[model samples]
Target: MFTRILPAFAAGLLAASPVAADTDIAFALDWRFEGPSAPYFLAIDNGHFEAEGLSVEITAGQGSLDAIPKVASGAFPLGFADINSLVRFLDQNPGAPVTAVMMVYDSPPFSIVGRVSQGISGIGDLEGSVLGAPPPDGAWAQFPILAEVNGIDVSTITIEPVGFPTREPMLAEGNVDAVTGFNFSSYLSLARLGVPEEDITTILFADHGVELYGNAIIVNTDFAAENPEIVTGFLTAVARGWSDAIADPLAAAAAVIERNPAGDQELEGRRLELAIEANVLTDYVRENGMGQIDADRMDRAIEQLRLTYEFTSEPDAALYFTDAYLPDAELRMIAPE
Candidate 1:
């Protein structure tokens, strides 16, 4: 399911070099500080970013799609966002200076999180149920494709457009039967809301027929074109941080707590572990390493998107992502323990 692709026009991919001076990098997170975001904090706490001669300030975002416009408008030089949303954004906006530079979630966390007590456990269970979905949720954006692939009739499902803050609470309060969200985020939220573990059911899109990549480290094409070394160095430090995080996710969560004092350390730690086990440390990542993606898989993802989206022009792989700024393969690999 993976094919190593060497892009002929990748400018900085061949050079394993360092940046000259400290560059101020403003990184925009796709969501609020949580378990999965620990690696970036670990990168900062462990001096990985500093070692790369970068002063990075991380900003929290509203949703997966929130970071797209921030990076495209040059508000943030780098960001974490859903590449599928980026595909749609590019189609609608035409010439946005943003593209995924590194693949973070090799397997997307998109899922329909439901409570078993609410008559939901599998994809088919969603029928005749009210599903709460945030309008901008990345998973909701892909619901059409999920439905098509699974043979679920979306018309039979009642979709209640909910806010991000209310998506889980609505389901937890029995306002809706299920919710579209990231598996880890919604599952943990329901648990925190006093929903029993046995009562929760997370039907991941990947487990079904969806072949989609998840959130990725996106960059402003303008910034990357001007400072390729800075981009490469930043990605190298990110790889180091993720490798360390995979080794000790509890430590990674502790790093996150250091930034957000209000965060529950135990909960975040569990969330981080879940993300590492379920999304980040997939067979592809374990065998091939991080950052770089499978070319064939990406093509399939594009085709999958084509099912729900109408591209303004021919979808060019180069315009969406590149391994140009990724670190060396060895540094990117997260060894299994």
Candidate 2:
């Protein structure tokens, strides 16, 4: 029972006299267009953004950290960012103001994969072993806290910045004992390369002390404040898009392929399959509905950031998001109708 709404501007124009015109929004992605970002592609391909009265111009971001400053300065009104980096930004730049409109992945998928034959049971055994990780500028900053929670000394582990495509081969060839990568893609790629599942050990961040949320839809605080209605409309449409994606993942993947013709169909399929398995909404927003944020989880994440990173001060929860924009009907979508 999917119902489509007309573009927000059209609905508004029809309801009222000819006044000021439509509003435009620019959305920045944390990486080049790919599968994990299918919902956004679906929204665009299916006219969801247009229906919400938004003319969205999507752009690829340098990375999560790079996206934040651009968003804060209004280089882009809205952007996708890693939740951990968002927390750090809030702590450092209190007045800059940003809010997460919706969460993309409820669980962090970053994991350390090691060969089982190496006797790496978990994070504890990684000590004294060479570990390949992305640069500290990326998600590597959180690895220390992950190690701490696992009773491993942060200093005892050597973190070499192994470039993205080289991580798998480096580990396989014994250049590094283990490597950090997305469990979803890396595991499947390893399997495709003939690495047996039984021979691999994965230490997921969610299973450790890194309990922060992952990819999130965020906007500049001023933009959210100045154009609350636009924000609400965008969020409402995004909610519908996520629901549509979850209800029919295969359709969603096809929609993604249609939008990004250059994308790899096999990789996108695998990515979507993994996303479904992760059940991104469970244990967090499932009860409240898609795109809902839990204040408690946010609070815990803030505390963890403070304790682990020695953040100078705590950030106020209200600054990060508002529930006012979420449509009531969309919030009920996760329930049995």
lDDT against the true structure, each candidate: 0.86, 0.68
TM-score of 2: 0.84
How much does each candidate deviate from the true structure in C-alpha RMSD?
Answer: 6.4, 5.9
Residue 175 in model 1: lDDT? 95
Best by lDDT: 1
Off by over 4 Å in 1: 1-18
Question: Can you write out model 2's per-residue Cα lDDT over 25-88, one digit (the tens) per residue?
Answer: 6677776555566777777767877876676666765555667876786666677877778777
Ten contiguous residues with the weakest lDDT in model 1: 1-10
Clashing pairs in 1: none
What TM-score should be assigned to candidate 1?
A: 0.93
TM-score per model over all chains: 0.93, 0.84
